[model samples]
Target: MTDLQIGNHLRKLRFLKGEMTQAQLSKNVGVTRQTIVALETSRYAPSLELAMKLACVFDCGVDDLFFWINLEDAKSKYSSDGQ
Candidate 1:
C-alpha cells in the first residue's frame, strides 16, 4: 500500500472553518505551528490522535476532513481496514 498525504484537506478544512491560521489551530490542537504548516503542505501526515484533534476543531469526522481529498487516490488505498 502507498502512504498517502492528507495535508491539502487540512488547509481546506481550516479555511472552511473560518480561515483559521496554522498557529491558532496548532494551539487548539496542541501541536506546533510548524507541524500545522507541515500538515497543510504535505510535509507531514498527522498521526491518528492529531488527525482526530483536527477533525474536532473543524467539527467534522477524520475521514471528512482528511482522508479523501487532495491525494484521494493515495488515501483510499490506506484508509480502509488500516490497509
Candidate 2:
C-alpha cells in the first residue's frame, strides 16, 4: 500500500491573510504558538475539532488547508483490477 501523508498550506494561507503571525493564529485557534509552529512545519497534525476551529478562523474549508499526498507511486500500487 502507498504511504498516505497529510500536507497543509498553512504558511501560505497565513501570508495571504495579511501575513498573520503564528502567535495570532494560535490565539485565534486557542492553541500555543508552538502548536502553530508544529503545524506550519508539518511536525504535528491537528485534531478534527482543531481543524474545524482553524477553518472557522480563516473562513475557509478544511480541504482548503489540508490535503492528502501519496509518498509512493500510486499508479504502480493500487490497480484497477483490485490486485
Best by lDDT: 2
Error of 1 at 10 (Å): 1.6
| Cα lDDT, model 1, residue 60 | 81
Task: For each candidate in turn, give its C-alpha RMSD to the true structure in angstroms.
Answer: 7.7, 5.9
Q: What is the alpha-carbon lDDT for the whole of candidate 1?
A: 0.77
Highest-scoring model, TM-score? 2
Clashes (candidate 2): 0
lDDT of 2: 0.88
Candidate 2 residue spans exceeding 4 A from truth: 73-83
lDDT string for model 2 (5-73, tens) is: 778988998998999999999999999999999988778989999999988888899999998877575
Residue 30 error for model 2, in Å?
0.7
Q: Total backbone clashes of model 1? A: 0
Q: Give the Å shift of residue 38 in candidate 1.
A: 0.6
lDDT of 1 by residue, 4-79 (tens): 4454477777777788888899899899999987777777878899888888888888887765344566567678
